[model samples]
Target: MILATCVAPLAAFACRFNVRDVGFVDLGSDPYRLYLYVGDSMPMAERESLQSISTATFYDSNVKPQLLPLAQARQSEARAFIPEDFTGGVPAAVLVSPDRKTTLSLPLAKSGVSVLQTAWEALEPIVDSPRRNAILEQVFDSYGVVMIVEGKDVAANTKVRSMVDAAVSETTSKLPGLEKEIQQPPVVAVISTEEMEAERAFLWSLGIREVKEAPRVAILYARGRMIGPVLDGERLNRESISAILDTIGLNCECGLDRKWMQGVMVPLKWDRDRKQQVAKQLGFNPESPEIRIEMSQILAKSGAGQGIHRSKIIGDTLDELLTGYRTKGLAPENPPKQNKKPFAESLEMNKPEASELMLSWVVVAGILILIAGGAIVLFARRRES
Candidate 1:
């Protein structure tokens, strides 16, 4: 019984899919249909792992497999049979080998390294298609990682790192429009088992400023274990994570958990002092919340009730509170307008003498009246004679 229980957790871990299961056959379900693309090269074991990880309630990963020959794969007709092509058009993340060049070339390429470019070249037209609305709905609902593992010649760890780098580059390059559409900067975090200290230094050299802001990149290295939390315990190394994130133009938070040859990389920010102060003022424990009547009352009054309304109400209340502080002179006053032009300066630049201008207008009007009077008198004298 003891052995069985111990083995069960391990079995569950093995059954779970990591980032590697991206390009496998999809069996309907919204998340799978939106996020994944299956290629002929995917192994059966990996396919099974993907299926196990996906909950059937939201996605079904057991659809009929469609295989295509490498030669025919380039054709639109043949590509149509692939899972991504059929369901929602194309996957957000695409995996193509180094030798298998794309029709549209990316900006930079490293020698002999595999590139996983965004399939945007093929997707742009489809996104504009009249039939693409439903597919877009699915894309918005699904979010997952794409993994591109290079074949035997490349080391497993190297392939993982290369693929992650390629994906980050590809995603970032295409994200300008996406940021505008979403109204928030996109976040990307890279976690790796290999440590690239020199690469981290090179990134900081490019002028990244602070790492917690949106549209930042973070890279983390895990030495031994393959998967776990990025860092263990309280103190997080903000400097290291910030540098890596800034290099890639992504806001990031990262930590290393030595147990899983893996590090967790996330685009999350935590302000230690701010959080502590907030916790203390709110009368709750830091790091974890201990419920009190006042806390409950605050939450309830601030709309912790339900739905999107909760966040909206809370935001409204916070805004009001801040505005109140400003009105009371607690907040610094805004600097007076520096661009206001003085009346004297304006008159000097565009001046006209008021008396001279009025006299000129009066003379012009008198001359017009004299001409009209002469014409009328000449007509009356001719009639009398």
Candidate 2:
């Protein structure tokens, strides 16, 4: 009892559900599908160039690259999405969205090695600015990020900007009471209208192609997964912003659907070094397949009402990942354990047999009758005397 009381407060501060871990596992669920077209008669140089994209650092692990022979490409379901007149020949490529709704094509490597280089650029366009760099750094170090994409109206943008500051302040005040200890408060970033063009690819990934009428807010956490829908108009209020931030600070096993907690990730390369730094902060490698698998399973079983021991599963996986957990920062402080049995199971285990209950009742009745008969005999003796 004493140990539990001492640890409970400390556990309240350490967030069990990390956004970075959630984002890393989310990538497993949704990866860009890159299909490379090839032919038996293709030149060795072109074939090699197309194959190199799979190992490219910028390609990121989130892209699943597949080599498809030209003959098989025609028979594939993807053939319908390809244009009839696309005579780009061998060494061509098609990039499909995770949902298979969007497709981008890279024409044949016509202009020697340079054309292939262009194809790589088109496949994964790197978009960054000074503001984006700060945002990325903050997300790595802090709990999450709240980004404001400014609109054309200066007055409206100014008004919405205050909303972020107020929301963040309120969220910070409530952090101590949260189930999870937040590493840091969410920081705010702004993308001016002028800089939006340079960050078109980044914005597009967040489903913001252009910000025209009013400024919008996007809440991103752990490798840049948007927490929920973009807030604008009347939805962009202090209370709404605080509510979402509060949501992220809770225990992930709280039964919220993964879909509600996760959205599209901003197109950014989460390389190994950055992942390592995040791992140190989180105390476990989110890059590990074992951890990712467990996280995916948790999200899959979310809201199922199954007697799934979620925290125990994740804690065991983390323990295996790092030995001497306390010294290495691999262990969650006082990880939640499902030690108590379910109500039905407890009743079944402790319930007495019906026969035993009846026998005990009969024995008690006989004792009471014997006492009553003895008392009556004593009363008759006194009367006779």
Candidate 3:
């Protein structure tokens, strides 16, 4: 009991689930969502389409409608309106509204990932596809501050909105020509301070001097560190905001400020199934030689590109591959015993039944011999007397 009490502090640090955090992303059953099934295997054209669509989901948060992998959609218990045949082929899309009153099954575009945007746009006129606000909470903090301005004053609001817009444009203007080189825009939100009473401490923590009383712009960056000028409402202008935006073009908001409440909010940041299945499809056999060579070729073909994401994904696949190896067919888990022995010795090592029977026979033979010897001894004694 004493030892357990002493070690109790260590228990709090242990992670019990795979998810880091789950942020609120309008998971209401009523919103329209597109369920896309891009299974393990895809032809060259289909694979290109899937990759493009998947990439779009990461970059543009405004691409209306949630993009849940069809496999995950069916498994997600939260979704009560899944159709019976959602388990079909690759490169398929099902668009459905919250009410289930209107549903449409659309053919995927073989042209490329453009299919994702096109598919959503088609549903815009017909259904009310609810979109979550594109405020990436503190995502680009390391790169630079994303000034979230909140106030009722028209002058303050106009000044901050102009500064925010100019900053985004100015920063994006200098990015490299390639799409992959560019990043998603950093988050900048303008809202009423009175409406954000619950976030007073959060605003204050961002270095805002007079949060509720005056026009304040909270600049969050350096992973939650506050910038003094913006919060104090002194340097709320184009030059200052652009200066900050220039440092980091855009940031990945995939896992940014995502939080969860236990098992209810498991992460979809990393797909556990697709990663393993895709690696298998790529013919990733860890047991084979020339692994590095094979991996390079596979990654090039995959079009996932070289980055932390590529490394992480391939690593996950290899881990699953090794796990598959360990659990494969009838391979002896333990080596055979070294010592050779006769059948009798082997039997003795086994259950006691055979040994017990042998002992019984020996005991009966000894009893008979003793009885005969006694009879002969008695006869001799009588004759001698």
Candidate 4:
């Protein structure tokens, strides 16, 4: 596979995606938090000298300054997480909301002391994460298997935690090949139930009460029965986790429905979001079929569009869009409207795509012709001599 390179990094960039290890934690209860760190270790004086007075560590950790490893120091460039243009030097921190949006960036201080705590407090009130929380919950719902660990017993659950992490890494690494075998990527949620005080009652309802011997283990699979793990009597181990992973969410047929791929669900949803954004921009009812159809066609023209095009659903929406655009006077100069649907739908589904055999035959035929020409010349020369 060929990778796209940055031809002119310093000059300009069409796009860039950073796939490094991004430091993330269960948002727990907070809508937003500050992630502060230096690229290299710094003395207390140097840390204190910085403008922001914030601690990057957890609740009970001691306050000291040091550089982080490649994994911990890695930052997210994912959508909503990327900060606006900031040429801030290293050791700078970013304030991220629950949805991974970078709300504020703390550039290194030139002079006077600027505590990170003050910025944290100031940004806390303004940050909100209702939408992000809902989306996260939806992902948890979709996962065929998920391991939930409590915040307090993380250290004790180290062995199992490592197992869970390994499973996740392996599943993700093999996800592309496993699409036909699995409904979704294997996922695990290492959450802080105590930090999420409100969810405690809900956990109890699901029979996962926090007792003294709380193993702090739970497996979630069924959307209908989102049950709590019975840490005591219930068997919670590597075998059980593996069983859950192997059994559920299989595609059954071992065939791909590219026209209706499960992977396109999120991007298809994004198309709706794009439609809504365009409608809001143009003052139209995005929810209306007419307006929605037009926005989808426009969305299919972008990066998100490329994925949407594969499902055939977006491709099917073309005629509707042309009609909608024409009706709204957006398709100027007497736009031609065809009542027929896209031609791709009419093609035979079972027919295999044509291979490169024809090209090979053409090359062979060319060689044969050249050989015959050489032979004719040789025969003529011998006869004449």
Highest lDDT, which number? 2
What's the distance in Å from true for residue 70, model 3? 54
Per-residue CA lDDT of candidate 3, range 223-328, in tens? 2223224433555555545533432221111111111111111111213443354335323432234543432233233212121111112122223323322332
Candidate 1: segments with Cα more than 4 A from true spot: 1-41, 44-266, 269-296, 302-322, 329-385
Instruction: State every prediction's TM-score relative to the real structure.
Output: 0.18, 0.64, 0.28, 0.28
lDDT scores of the candidates, listed in order: 0.28, 0.64, 0.39, 0.36
* Pairwise TM-score winner, candidates 2 and 4: 2
How big is the positional error of residue 22 in model 3, measured in Å on the Cα after superposition? 22
Model 2 regions lying over 4 Å from their true place: 1-15, 18-21, 24-27, 35-42, 57-60, 66-72, 83-85, 89-94, 103-113, 124-133, 289-385
Tell me the lDDT of candidate 4.
0.36
Question: Which one wins on TM-score?
Answer: 2
List the lowest-lDDT window of 10 residues for candidate 2. Answer: 304-313
Q: For residues 1-385, what per-residue lDDT tens digits would candidate 4 score against the true structure?
A: 0111222322221111000000001112233344554434455565564423333232221112222322345443322332344223344545444344324454433335554334444322222223323433444334434545454555656766776667565445543442232235656665454434334323442344453333455444322122223333245555444433432332212111211111111100123444454345324443466543433333233221111012111222323323333343111122235536546754454333343345445555666777789899999999999
Ranking by TM-score: 2, 4, 3, 1
lDDT (Cα, tens digit) per residue for candidate 1, span 25-67:
1111121111234344556564354333322212211112122
**How far in Å is the alpha carbon of 317 misplaced in model 1?**
8.6
The C-alpha local distance difference test score for the whole of candidate 1 amounts to 0.28
Tens-digit per-residue lDDT, 117-217, candidate 2: 66666555433345666787887777788899999999999998887898888667766655456668788989999988667656766767776879999
User: lDDT of model 4 at residue 39?
Assistant: 34
